[model samples]
Target chain A: MKVNKYITIYKDMVRQIESGQRKAEDVLPSENDLCDQYGTSRETVRKALNMLAQNGYIQKIKGKGSVILDREKMRFPVSGLISFKELSETLGKETRTTVHRLGLILPPSEAAKELGTEADEKVWEVVRSRRIDGEHIILDKDYFVKKHVPLLTKAICEDSIYEYLEGELGLSISYAQKEIVVEPAGEEDRKYLDLGGFSHMAVVKNRVFLEDTSLFQYTESRHRLDKFRFVDFARREK
Target chain B: MKVNKYITIYKDMVRQIESGQRKAEDVLPSENDLCDQYGTSRETVRKALNMLAQNGYIQKIKGKGSVILDREKMRFPVSGLISFKELSETLGKETRTTVHRLGLILPPSEAAKELGTEADEKVWEVVRSRRIDGEHIILDKDYFVKKHVPLLTKAICEDSIYEYLEGELGLSISYAQKEIVVEPAGEEDRKYLDLGGFSHMAVVKNRVFLEDTSLFQYTESRHRLDKFRFVDFARREK
Candidate 1:
């Protein structure tokens, strides 16, 4: 599939920003200059800049042009379907994924419904907790369809199952519908995470789909209340 | 400014969905059919459909084409910067807004910093609570730059300041950076909302910008933990 021109520009600028080629707080080239350089119209350049702004790559200051943001302050964006391993690598932090359970089991009814599987269908259930800098902050319960991911191992879960799914299996994770809510810590959450006396948890319920729009995974990530923070950049409709 | 062709198609389709011209659970026209009807390429048609999916207007099901989701089940989308009035109208519920406070005052340093206003500068501070089904579930604290909204009244606040800003003031709200966190409930939340002994609240901190990229408003929406739900549709980058 061919990418849109504005998206190409957006990705190029994001790469430059993340690579530190475009310094934080430094204003990018004006729309006119970017249009001239990219051989695109000014509107297209603006579109690219808007995408950057919406994704927290840059902030369009009033008098100043699009200026890069302090990327260090922004952690892994919860808006995307990214693995903890990839997020830790992006942040250059020492992170460890401890797989508590990994096996094929009959999924619960809710999980089956979300994954579009039958009641008796076998699915891989992986329970893992992500420790960042020696603090267990997130506990993830993931269920994947057996048809989509036939093989599962604790080692792969400890490392990155997403890497195996995308690299070895060549499966593309396309999109997801995520619901976030705050709930009282359950027994499972208390057992998995070091609660630090927090009574609530930020629960993210995710229904992940593949590129062909097949429901493949259902995950719930519960984070300690005080440690949970979600940041999003959104544009208002015209 | 000229709107993109695909965006126009996307908007039209969204209107159709919201207005019930296309019922929920109904599959939309096939890609080829849409391309033929709109005189556009398949890629452009797909682009429009992707926008619809991202905005929760439709869900692309595997082998079933695009299907309209039950909009009522999906509450206010966390992906867009929308006003309560607009959201309530979309839900078609008898939602009422009660203004608790409306005045111009010196904002706190944090609010001033977020809105990019001087500490000495007067800003409009509005406190309101949303009542849905006879229960107060949300309390909103909004601070706007006085220069942007020179005049304000409790009546307008009771109705919709966003409407007045966009319709009468001709100010186009472009985008916002929002942070969601769970915090212990405060005295203000206890007094304003019927939190029902819940110890925590889901707080949404928003910094809104105008079309010209000027920070104009800072708002904090506090919701009872049990009543809070945030939904978002996201696509992975290839």
Candidate 2:
């Protein structure tokens, strides 16, 4: 429901940057050009440009307009257990949430291990579909040990479960362990994703912990192959 | 070139596990069942089953046939500095590496920030296409600051760059800093990935560091939207 015109314009600018149409170090077509192209006011263009600068997408200098920023050495930590809402906010993009399935379910063994609970334990299975840039691309089936999060419903599922957890129940997200995979889209996945044809799925598995490093949730995020990725920064020994 | 046959069968088993057709805790359709279904030998089927058991995909009791593992509590990590080769290997899937583009080039500004090098520094830009389960899903474009890696070529790009870095050149990969983003695909990406009308790309940015935590390489892996993902585990605080 929260939409911003500037963010949309900034996104289009990024497309230009990533595609190589706007080379790194290439000064942008002035805020005036952006305003003209986006058909928005100068203030709106500045807001969008500001978001880009904060996220390291581009840089602006006084009296010189902005220069497209290079993305060479930038990295964000995946070790932090972040909710989609948290991540989307960090990325400065308009994120929309959809609840496909949310209910109490018995923990399957694999899901059980990730949750640090016994097989057959009751867990809150919250299946969330995330939309970024008006595309519903990620299907997240998150499992919370019933002890931590109790009394959930289909309506709560439609909203940010993390918000309900932190804002309503007063819980926090801390540390996490994660695994990544690239696989083919299957029948169950196809039903939800609605891909015209068979597509690959990027499967990410993780164990989420609280600030004190207490394990709280187990999440399996299925990304439409083209939309899921993980980046990192490492130091080299001399 | 080292592909595991047990894994090929395991993938099919995983497919069944995911589909409602195969319920958890229920014993698998027997190694013999698998052999008939997959048209392979009993040994091959057992090996596949063993892999499943090893990765927590299934459980095997000595006298009884293997039990289908429950997957609801699965832990998929979204955060970590993990390698594609390692991920595919862990899943026991056959991952083929394809070189789309590779060469040395000057570090772009954003890339320089990630490489922790000078903006004008030279680096090797290596682009590799990743195929798992016969699907070309990810295109990884890696930028290496010259001091860490002195040589580059299309042939080197064909094999695992990390393999060569660790084995031939001794650039041990200690850890990496990472970030993930969901965005639309650009023209440069379309050339490397056969994205057929797919609209988005998952951009994973990584800066590789050594055991000493010194930054040496920067890689931006672009996952086609349909095939991108991140998973993880977590716990809540009281």
TM-score of each prediction: 0.86, 0.47
Give me the displacement of residue B173 in model 2, in angstroms.
2.7
lDDT of 2 by residue, A98-133 (tens): 887777877664455667676666888777777778
Off by over 4 Å in 1: A1-8, A19-50, A53-74, A109-113, B1-8, B18-36, B39-47, B56-73, B109-113
DockQ of each candidate, alpha-carbon based: 0.56, 0.20
Q: Give the chain B TM-score for each candidate.
A: 0.82, 0.62
* Model 2 chain B: ten consecutive residues of lowest lDDT: B229-238
Model 1: clashing residue pairs? none
Model 2, residue B203: what's the lDDT?
79
Candidate 1, A155-197: lDDT as tens digits: 8888888899999899889777889988788877788888998
Q: What is the lDDT of residue B36 in candidate 2?
A: 89
Weakest 10 consecutive residues of candidate 1 chain B by summed lDDT: B107-116
